[model samples]
Target chain A: MKILFPIILYLVVSLLLLAPCALCQDEVSGCVNCHSELDDGDIEAPTELFKNDIHNQAALGCVGCHGGDPTSDDEDLAMSEATGFIGVPDPTDIPKICSKCHSDPVFMKSFDPGLAIDQYAKYMTSIHGIRNSAGDTKVAQCASCHRAHDIRKANDPKSSTYAFNLPGTCAACHANNVYMAGYDIATDQHTDYERSVHGIALLEKRDIGAPACNDCHGNHGAVPPEVGSIDKVCGLCHANNMTNFDQSTHNEYFDALEMPACETCHSNHYVDSPSTDILDGETSVCAQCHNSDESPEGLEAADGMRKSIDSLNTSLTVVKEKLDESDRKGLFVTNALFTWQEARQKEFAAKTAVHTFDLGKVTGVTAEGLELASQADVAADDLLAGYVFRRAGLAVSVFFLGLLALLLWLKARQIDARQQSL
Target chain B: MIDRRSFLDWLLGGTVFAGLAAILYPAARYLEPQEIPEAAISSLKVGTIEDFPLDSGTIFKFGRKPGLLIHDADGKFRAFHATCTHLSCVVQYRKDMGAIYCACHNGRFDINGKNISGPPPRPLEEFDVHLKGNEVYVSLRG
Candidate 1:
């Protein structure tokens, strides 16, 4: 009996020593069991919330985050401070809590090879992080946007930081006048964005190609786009427009006057679709800055550009209508249509050249368009004239054929009368 | 003496012959292809060295097809058929990209006539360039 007792006691002690390590490898842990069975709402809420968390899906238990004896059923042993049990981290410490695994390159690679580990580093440079580090608890923490227990990948549609959802996530704080009052920032950015062309494209049309909040401000290191860099931010999508603007004479002028390039006329948050109306007239963008009394040459150039574009557009429309008429009359109008297409391309080129802010360049392209339009018009007119000539020739040929038939009949009658007289 | 029946038979035969000749003459003329005068020179003179700016390309007519003449940044003249090998869309020299680009399908080719990107399945057809006394001439490759 004594020998058996000693062997059994040694086995029990060894199993007890190795129990926590084994539980860590298992799918379930004692921490979840205790917390789930607790009647207190505070303790039970975390267990329920943790069930849907990404960590939970990865088989990470409460012990993975809180640090405790996950193998122990005893409350005293499970919550013991010696086992590194940190019940709840402070708001300021939440970023560090998330960054523990996120910042470790080796650890993060095991989860996602392509996922960047620079979020924590970038977050440090953000206004929120700077303020949070300064002991301001009101500012956004990692949990505020990502949600503490149920964090998801940014690409996930349900994620708060998804491209389509980011604007709303940011507006939650930014749009609230009370929240922004302390920061002395405009709270109507969201309202203004909802009405802008980009916002309508994203929110109303549901176009994934459209820009959202983070597309310009950046997500991790969010900041208002600087005046000097705003053109580049917009250029990410409007490459051709940006290229044209960069090469324009206004580039140097805007830089010298410390004016934002695109926003000077287009506005910042409420950029509308461009129209030719912005090129001339009393309400023209140029007239807003340059009046005939002050800048006669600039006004004349603007007027000339507007008139040239208008003339090309009018000529193109007239030629297209004529071609369509000829086509409807069963005439071969393919050649005329091809010429019209060339004119249309020239007109588009002329519009693009307007960004050059050079009247000669605009007029040069418009001249080509006008010439093409005239050629197409002449081609259609020729086809219609050919149709008229064909009808007249057919009528003349029918009259001559009738006359020939009558003459043959008369000759036959003469021969028959001669035979009768014989 | 010529009888009336014999005279009538001769007149009917002549009328049929005239009608047949009138129809056949027009038909023959319509079927015949119109002759266009061909230029005697196999090679086309594009321009002088002063006419073509350095590091730029100019499109000129080579018989029926469009030819591209490029004066590369190194001051060497190179010529290629402007039509893309994929869909025969004319390619333009993009100074920004430093490559020949077809706006049709976004096909691109290097200055050396190498197909680089997009839908172009073959390099641009290169032409032989002849330089004489500051004048540039281009001919189809043998």
Candidate 2:
């Protein structure tokens, strides 16, 4: 009784201790074990790659996405339709699958409390989402931008949705003309975006703050901005210019004409650095809509604003030239540099103020700028004049000192002669 | 006493002093820090309560930048940085709109300085409005 009772007690205690661990074993799934032993690369790749997946790290297994029996060792049982095994879900069903867990605040919060749960809700509003709902299989889904098995956090550099990689990820579907054949939209957006000011800043300069494909056109709720809201989209970063434009006379006129406020002047997707030539030169954007015959007032305003900007620019150039000259000559021009910086700031304000379309308002800012530039020019002039004065004084001192030395030399010669006679 | 040697020594000494002064005078001026103005505007007495009527807002200069002060419909005073978060344009209070408006992008902020609409990515920076004997003063928030 003693030997049998001790053995039974030992077995019962061992089972009691290890039963919870067995029940709680998330990694005990049959899917990966069998999938890893597959002869086919296509069937086996996911098992190997998913070992390092973010979902795996979070303790989610194939059953979480594919939905099958995880504990069963029989291949037929694990892959059986009766167990709800859905192998290779359709693209249209991808959002539903992802949002099942992602859309639930309580479920998402358990993993990441701060993670946004609105993506699925916002995705429904997007063109892609609307198309996907209509049974269009080619449109982007959750797995398109974020890969199926190798998903990582958006902030991860290796993530497909990382700011730097997002462009290429979007381009994968968007850049293919054949893939986008039925759509009315152009496929040139990706290539055009690559050469744009925003793209250069983000792609080449690696400035994450620079807007990517998702900034203007939202990521989940992507849409082309309306004509009226184009300025608002651009103004998200170009706040000062938007401020001037929103209050300008052209705001109502453009709204009535259905002309995009910013895209009319700054081309969408391929915006280049705006030069003053766009205002007064042969390639004037204002001249496109305005003429000396019909829209005389607009052309006049453009001319006046252009001339005001030009005047300040010319004065600034002159002042800068003078400052540079002083610096080159090794003159102390700190005060002048400070004055130049203030003047340059005013010039920038004036340029932004041009959106006001008020000639007087632009000239008012430019007038202040011109005055500051004149002051800087005067300072630079003084620096140059002081240099000249110092040089002249030096010449005069050298001449006088040379004359004194000659006199001293002659006196010494006379003294030597007198000493020899003695 | 009036020898050439002494005269030469005096000349050399004057030349050396002039050279040293030329070098050291500018250096001293360069090294000497400019007297700093109030390093930052932590606090300012913007105006009296009477200056801003009920349900009124105004932009007041706070040092180099501008600040917006509002007297809400509830008769409470609120102050915030007037600059728009998107493009740094000075925001204005539209009486008809009853919200702080950035004319640049139609960005709107509530009386509480929260960004409500348009393109601004951040809310307006709020300040503490202190009332002392009918005088309204704006101070940086703790």
Candidate 3:
């Protein structure tokens, strides 16, 4: 009786240890099977679309969100409200539903510990959240951007919030005049953004590092930048340019005049690449604020900055052309090419330095660039001269060798004649 | 006074020798082992535990790049790569904010090296911090 009791106790302990392993295995939900069999498109569609959801991939069942008796095979009993089943949750309740699992550190740690938990808190401050809470059904909710049954990780290429796809996802409602008719904002943002430098880089070049719709406009707490905050928003990427702009004389004037710093010159969505041409003439960005009669000093500074950039740009172009010419001749202009690259960086620095609005600061960088360009120009010239010298030396060697060959031929003929005579 | 046969033979021998030397010299160098610098140090003794006061941060050179070693207010030693994820600009620990801050763009990273705010798309890479007695050592995390 004692031996039997010990064996029974051992078996019971072993069963307790193995129980978690059995339950931890991928669970097959009976609800999906029953829903899949249903003739109703609304019922069957979730089961089909859920196959691709991030939750489904993580082995979470339909009961994870829409709770029901996942254990039962009977259709009516399985979906009973007694088990806390809630189907087709309202838009307002979706955030709460998502945050229940997402915001739990202990629960989320098993999946992704690095994922931020404050998305719901941030969303509450957004315009969409405020409008949605006010009983407006038209505004976006958690399910609006991230589809209910087919939500994916933001990094997934197929995700609605992926860097390349995000602009288009936002444009679905934003670009439609009918949908956005109630809003006071212009609907041309998506169109303008599509043609912008950032858009071209992200969508065409597939550069994920480039800013998307969410980079400037917050992903959850999205709002338009006010007049005072425009420079701060633009400064995130162009840190040096922002630093210079902050110290510029125009900063206080722009603040007093209520002009947006970077956007005033570089336009917000449709920022085109700037050139020296923008510094002067009828199309000058400065002309919008400064006139020739009233602010002649402003015009003078702008003109000087333009000439400084042009001078350095012209020198870089000429040096680059020389390097290309030398390279084509197969003169091995590696040094000259490297010098030109350094000069190119200096030119870029000078361009960014123009935000200081000081002629001296801009010229300081440009002067260093001009020196590098001059060095490259000299190196290319040396290579060309060396090529010419090598060509002349080759001609000299060929003439003497030809003369030697002729003499050898004559001497061989003379030896043949003497042998024949002997 | 030299005959054509003898002169041609001499020239042929010199040309073949020159060609052989040119080919064999480069081949020998290619096969030979180059004296490269020693392998990168896997673990570095940053300093003694006493060198780092509570909540104080210090920067040290790790190989060619910079590394940030912080003695947090929690009394744990942690280290991270000092470069910002947004740009390649070097980052500094902002004691005031109690976070790794990049002044270049105001990018902020939490103690766990997770990017909290600003333009950083990715997190700063973290290194393993080991304490052997009073000596603190930082090493690459496996």
Candidate 4:
């Protein structure tokens, strides 16, 4: 009985040690069990918030990120330095901690084969990364946008880094007057972008293809597009307009002045659709730079281009109306209508040619349109003339037929009277 | 004997030829390169020492192309063709960056005209710089 009592005490002690290990093997570790029972808000908050986290949903436990032993139920044993328990990482060390698994291509591929592993490398090149490396803890780190405990995929609509939500997410830090006061950045970019053409397309129209904050400024390696590269950024959409601008003499002139290419005229945040008003008169973008007193020849060229475009548009309208009138009169003005359509196409070509900023090119295209419009007008006039000739010919034929009928009636009456007298 | 139709055709053709020559002659003359008397000077004097402040760069015309002259912070002068090696764009001295900067592509070059960063593939072509009694002279190197 004494030997049995000693054996029973040994068995109870061994089972107490083995019970936590058995619980750790069941997926809910000793760390979660102890933390769930804690009354501290700091300890309980992460446990509760982590329930819906992407990492938690993927079955990655707290020890995967926090770096502690999950099997031990004793607080000292689990949180000991010997077990590699690094508590909350500092702001400067956060990026490196995230990159441990993110930068590993093999690890990232296990979850998503196509996921890029260069985010850490690109983050090192960003202004935030550069400043952070220089020991500025105020700069944005991994947890700034991708919330630490509850990060979602960038494609998820609820994600702070999602395309549609990025503007508001950026504005959280950027628009805060007290937060951005130390940095010399203008906080109006978010407000300006919301009203711009790109902003309207993305926000109001819900166009997924329209660009947001990360489109012009890159995602991980976010930086202001350099003065020389502004055209290249805008050219991703306005390719043909950029091609025309790049090939013009203005490209060399602007480059000589060290000017931002596309932003100099169209602006960066508030780029509106271009119109003929940008080429001429008091409100002209050209007139803003070139006046008759300063650049007489340049002013003359701009004026000539505007006049040519206006003339071509007027001629097209007049010819189209005349062709429509002939069609309404039951005249087959198909050939005239075809010529008028060609004129309209030429007018569009002339407007695109104005980007060359060359009067000769604009006038050359406008001249072709003018010639086609005149030809169409002539065809419509001929159709109307032919209609009038046919009407006159029909009236004359009717008058001659009436005369013949009268003469025949008189002859018949004379023959009847002669028969009665006999 | 020439017929009347042939005589009229010759007259019309000659008139058209005269009209075309009248229009093309002015255009050809307009396109022709004009002689600049100032470009004849081979060793052009850019400016005096006082005109170029310490740690400053000035662009001067070397015949038709632009030439860049930099008076570095240490009071040493260097000269090179202003054109960028990548796209022939005019490069300027950025006091903030303390390097020769080509705004066209964000290309940079060291004081000695070595291509350092960005898209520039080759060094800027160096020019012979001579200082004679505070007068800076730049000329194409032989």
Scoring each candidate complex against the real one, what DockQ results?
Answer: 0.06, 0.10, 0.10, 0.01
Candidate lDDT scores, in order, read 0.79, 0.82, 0.81, 0.78
- Model 2 chain A is weakest, by summed lDDT over 10 consecutive residues, at A20-29
Each candidate's B-chain TM-score, in sequence, is: 0.72, 0.72, 0.72, 0.71
Taking all chains together, the TM-score of candidate 3 against the true structure is 0.72
Ranking by lDDT, best first? Answer: 2, 3, 1, 4
lDDT of 3 by residue, B110-139 (tens): 987899987677999888999999999999
Best by TM-score: 3
Q: What is the lDDT of residue A246 in candidate 4?
A: 92
Cα lDDT tens digits, model 4, B12-130, are: 55545555555565577679884344335567789998999988899876654677999999999899988888656678887887899875446789989998876566899998889
Segments in model 4 whose C-alpha atoms lie over 4 Å from true places: A1-52, A306-352, A363-422, B1-142
Any residue pairs clashing in model 1, and if so which?
Answer: none
DockQ-wise, the better of 3 and 4 is 3
Q: State the lDDT of candidate 2 residue by residue for A110-167, as single tens digits.
A: 8888889999889999999999999999999999999988899998999999989999
For residues A162-261, what per-residue lDDT tens digits would candidate 3 score against the true structure?
A: 8889998888888889998988888888888878877786788676766787788788888778899988888887777898999988999999999989
DockQ of 3: 0.10
Q: Give candidate 2's TM-score.
A: 0.72
Angstrom error of the Cα, residue A347, model 2: value is 2.1
lDDT of 3: 0.81
Q: CA RMSD for every model?
A: 11.3, 8.3, 8.7, 22.8
Sort all candidates by DockQ, best to worst: 3, 2, 1, 4
Candidate 3 residue pairs in clash (backbone atoms < 3 Å): none
